[model samples]
Target: MTDNRTDPPFVADEGPMLHSWLDWQRETLAVKCARLSQDQLRLRSAEPSTMSLLGLVRHMTDVERYWFRNVLTGENTPGIYWTDRHPDGEFDLVDTASAEEAFARWQAEIANARELSSGLPLDLVGKGLRGGEEVSLRWILIHMTNEYARHNGHADLIRERIDGATGE
Candidate 1:
């Protein structure tokens, strides 16, 4: 896959720098999934593990919606894929899942997250609480970057296993 991720800026204010790194991580995941067939994407990493590129996309979509829309913006929305009865559905149910739909949902979540966060400052506290503690927009941003970074590492191994493709 072609890694189209551009380097984040060397010098920038805190907010822009964080967003830049997050964006780069997002693009890196896309690059990892690029040019792959649905079967390739849905291929599990190994027995007893449900990790897959398509599953990661779906999981991230839910993560974005949970944090940005539900938590940060105080929207009372349910999760995109998982539920009490079908937890881990994003990763477990992939035999018939549509990659196109998954990607579309992921992209939409990203756009909505960007729009919902546009005017908020880093210091602004989120409307939702984590572990009974208030969370800041800055923390969410950093947490999300870390989330993507860790998942992208898994994506790297899965992609390489799928087609022997490897890179940044």
Candidate 2:
């Protein structure tokens, strides 16, 4: 699969820098999952671990929705793959999951997140609560970039285990 990920600018303002890094991380995850079959995507890192490429995609979908829609925009949207009964459903429920659907939802959520935050200043406060305090869009962007970077590390290992493929 074509990785088409763009490098972040060497010098940029805060918003552009944050979005660029986040976009790079998102594309890195996509590259890790590229050209893999649905069954392969469902392959766990090891026994007793539910992590997988598909699971990561699903988890990020919910993460995007939580921070951008539910928290930032106060959209009252439910999670895409998580619930009270299955908090880890994103990872645990991938046995028969459709990779196409998962990717589509994830991409859609990414677009929505961009739309929701496009006009708002980075310093603008969000409705989302974290540790009993409201957060800012800038904080959410940084947090999400960090989130994807951390998860992409796991994705690197899993992808290599799946096919001996490795790289940034």
Q: What CA root-mean-square deviation does each model show from the true structure?
A: 0.8, 1.1
lDDT of 1 at 158: 97
Cα TM-score per model: 0.97, 0.96
Give lDDT tens digits, candidate 2, residues 1-168.
467899999999888888888889989999999999999999999989999999999999999999998778767788889899999999999999999999999999999898888868899888867677888999999999999999999999999999999988
Across 5-40, the per-residue lDDT of candidate 1 in tens digits comes to: 888999998988988898899998999999999999
Q: Give the distance in Å from residue 132's predicted Cα in candidate 2 to where it truly belongs.
A: 2.1
lDDT of 1 at 159: 95
Off by over 4 Å in 1: none
Badly placed stretches (over 4 Å) of model 2 are none
